[model samples]
Target: MEGLEIGLNGNLVDAETQQEGGRFFAADASSSNYILLQCKDVLTLEQKEELKRLHVTLLSYPAYNTYYCRYEPTELDEIRALPYINYANIYRPEFVTEAGLKDKLENSDEGHQPPEEKRYEVYISLHEDHRNRLEQIRQKIIQVLGIDPELVNADAFILRAKLQSHEIARVAGIDEVQRIEEIPRLALSNNHARVDLNLEYIIGAANSRLVVGGGLGQIIAIADTGVDDQHEALRGRVRVIEGSRNTDARGHGTHVAASAIGSGNSLEFGPIQGTAPFATVLSHVIVDNAGNITWSPLMFQRAYNREYGARIHSNSYNVSHAGIFQQRQYDGLAQDCDRMAICLPQLVILFSAGNSAPFKNVTSDGEIESQAAAKNVITVGACESTRPMTRNPLTYDYYVAVPIPGYLALNLAGNRDQMALFSSRGPTKNTNGGPDDRRIKPDVVAPGTVIYSAKSSQLDLTLPNILPGAIEAGVPNDGRWSYMNGTSMSTPLVAGCCATIRGRIALQCHNLARIPSVLVKAILINGTKWMVGTNQDSQGFGRVNLAKSMVCFSNHLGCGFWPKQESDFARMQMIQGQELKIRVPLPTANPYPDGITPRFSLTVTMCYLDYPDQSGLVDHLSLKVLQKTRLPDGTFPERYGNKLPGEPADNRNNVQKVIWDGISAPAPFQHPDPFRIYVRVERLARDAQFLHHFALAWHVEEMSRGDAQFDFWNERMPSTDARNRFMRKD
Candidate 1:
């Protein structure tokens, strides 16, 4: 309205229809009495005056924020809504980065005489057993810090205090004090993005008829800016955070939530839906009107506890850029949350690999960014789907198409299956205790091109790009749907993949109720189809194949579902230098009715939530696979702690992958009778949190074409067998 002119070819008509003056107004779907006029560009003074004359309120812009009007313009000091009783909470981030807040916090500490009247925010971790010393520590902390404390966790026995964080360490001599660390400035992660990542062909959502992969029994937590619960695509499915109003103001959170799991059943946008339509998304608006993600981790804990807890958390946001050298406070908080996840195996966090792009971060030459460095969480990057074509330049020539992900020979932008130029790459900044320790990052990549999903209706009221003359202007609006691109979009696809998998695992459909996060991570990586000419930095393992992952989890495609006679599950907590070994049978490949010789392999992957080492290092855990063969005495040589020469062994990463390949003339196959997984957790620094909790997943899979087996699922008695899920029916 600001820059629009009012003229109609000398016809002198009212500004109600057509390009002369009324080129924008689009009527609301439910009521023709309402009309929308979204200005293609910023408004001019005349357009503003015209909009005022029409009594229209400004809403969103190219920035994608949803603003109905200012609080004062409505003449209200506060939002009277039940949950959003306070209007100030609606503002965006005041500070998005830790460096900015660090200066302020440091400034608050230097050259100042403490005034008893002033209050500050601080975090304290107690060393004593929480069950018995919780109250004791609370009273002692209050007495020493001389300020009130907000209890954060009873198990970890953590607290946020009004006392300055630096002062807490000074008072640690006052008993019950273990360690005191300053809390970082919390801000919402900026994931502002992919559609095929959510599409059925890639992830098997529609292929399964929406029964298993459509997120039937899974729940996801979207901790971001805000979600517009009233949006047609998410109406019945959204439950806003308790204290926040059920609406989106920045529009980022809304876009993210809908893309990850929107139902898309609403009349306005039924043609498109989220990767996990049946999944529940709980919104936690950590970013305020100031546009920062700097809220307390306490808020996340509360949301995590909601409705029996969410199985997966999709975070399109982060604490800082990847160059941050393993942030102490933030990384600690992430690890603490991961510890909670191990206790509840289904709880896993998925983070965007980041959008830093072709250029590496200053702190790290690798693309790995801040929150994406966490050990337990799944970090995802952006990969675009592309098709190749060739044509003669000087002569008349017909274009020939090349298939994608595999077909494209060289990495090129605007081409399919290639790693997105914008996705953060990785050789993560040293997470291990030493400067030399670097781990492969961005565990996987997914589609992150121009992805179309539900748009925020509450946001588009002003910019009706889809109505009337605006369509000719080539706006990217489709009424209730919008297109976005980034790692943010790709991450949700992975989260939805987890949801779909868990739905089949936990909903009485499979023999096993759950699988360890590490196992799932390993299976997903194992199942991925590698991109052409990609490395550990650009694409960790490869693109996740939803059908393959599902096939593996169900004990098909040569996988052994845990808790079976040959498969097993265990949750372990080990101390520094301690080793835990789990052994599962190794099956030999045999010929089937098809008369094709098959090969076999075993995979053992162990995963755990790693906290900053007492020395503040990140990586300190390892998993090893050792072959155990029966000797002439009919006893396994490695069974009695005896080491045999020529034994096959691999002690790789915390995410260990061991395989026994076939077709070598020397052995033909390397299938050991029983495979032993030795997980050694090393603590270089004594101050390290000694108890390392972990989950182990062991499976025996056929490396080649093998005989078919009976379906494992028995409606009467569940079994971790694959016959019921994926074999040609008899």
Candidate 2:
């Protein structure tokens, strides 16, 4: 009465005993025996019947495997049953025999390796089940061949052939950089100008004799629509890193790279140069034929890690899908990608905020989504200029597609305060209660509306069909020099600015990481002008004023208003019976270098009305030191209120305290030579509302020395100035 066991597909079963322990059998009787068979390729009918005759129960048979299996199982009783198998219902079978399994594992790299190799070890990315099976097959191979698996690893390694020369040539020529050609007056039209980028601004900001980006030997990686190396503006500056089959497929990348560092000049039919002008470009194409940026950040990581001396990477594409952060796969990849991006010692990654403007809600996925959301990368947004118009009013034909008066001639006036409605708005907030962390989309906003830059000759002319009126207006619309607008246009502006700052810092300090924080502070404070009614959400810190920033840098005056101690100070103070208490406000700004110390001067003007009884007790004032306190061990002590070397002591007489009488009659002061003490006023009536006004001025040597920046003000001012003005009473 021994229990019988069976095996199928190498699954062991004992006919004498039902216990689990037994020698491996090729077939089993129980329905569970089907689990042992690997369900990969199809099985034959003969194999199925052979399996059935061996008393093995078949759970499923793949169409292709049906030819390998023999004799299908049928009922033994007096009952007729048709085989419950159909083409659609058939399932693939796994390798049953040891030799079959070994063959399956060994053939994994069949087509991947070169033909010269006798044997190849393939690195296969497989599911857990397949990996386990492969591991078992490896052990069996070692046992049968009497060789160590480690020693066999070398013989098993696969060898792949290098890319063909033609393929390399094709990729190299994909986005061949071209020289910019000057368009004649006949070609000059309104449609062409709309796409014209402000190359002047880019060049002007980068014109610094003290700093040149030419010999830094830093490589800037561009992931976009591939570059036009043949463009005159970009001629010798661009170097292709990775070119896809669909090279020259798009002009976005070329335009972006040129805007950042084009070396040609537009006036002489020369190159329409960029901001850097001499920085080498390492181009990598990421966009596809569908006009979509489908490549993930992993591709960027691969590109970055492949080379040793690469630093900066720029991408002008944005994602449309918003749920990337919610998915585990995307989030993990994003974090890893960000780490990879910032891993380089001097690495700086830049991304376009997106073009989904006026809408203000939509965003993209992968790099676009990750860059905007990633803390390490710089995300750029677009802003339009509203300064008084300086250019002449040129008459041009208007577009019929535009809702405005069509077919009418209009002056090209630049005095405007409007921003493009299509430029994307960020500080991305996800409504879906997922990990909706608020990302400050654009760290800085640059001029992106109707920018002019170099383009490729191969660009499809049909693209203008999207906006026929824009094309016919002759607004610098040539395929080489286009006037496209969007945050995509704005991103390179900031990236160029970053390059300029980095170059300058490298010349002076030899550190690149210092540039990000320094530039962030400068742009946030000195370079930014506060626009009325705007908050931090929309406009952030306002427009980037390079002139003002340079001025601040030279003057050493820290940008932005320093926070006064009064803002955080409490009013009441305790006084001891035996001693008088004196309080002084501390200076909020950091001190300059030792020899060039900041000079702080305070002037107080006091007016007093003569009273008959108090005439003889005229207001008296004197300055004196109360007590000097040491800073705590772990804390950075306040510097302003600290007592100087020499000073008089606080007096008990109420009428002898420090005082100011006015311009005509000044009050006496103590200890004026070596050092002055805190000024105080006495003899004031208890009910009096004493006017205590003082002006504190200090000189700052360099704005770049310390952090003097604030977040940008959003553009959301109240409808009326009176309602939003800080000084207004109403």
Top lDDT hit: 1
What C-alpha lDDT do the candidate models reach, one value each? Answer: 0.49, 0.37
Alpha carbon lDDT of residue 604, candidate 1? 47
Indicate the TM-score of model 1. Answer: 0.61
TM-score against truth, every candidate: 0.61, 0.44
Regions more than 4 Å wrong, model 2: 1-217, 243-247, 267-272, 302-308, 321-337, 359-370, 385-418, 430-437, 462-474, 477-479, 511-526, 531-533, 547-730
Which tens-of-lDDT digit does each residue in 534-575 have in candidate 2?
433444434544333333222122212111233311211211
Q: What's model 2's overall lDDT?
A: 0.37
The whole-model C-alpha lDDT of candidate 1 against the native structure comes to 0.49
State each candidate's clash count: 40, 100
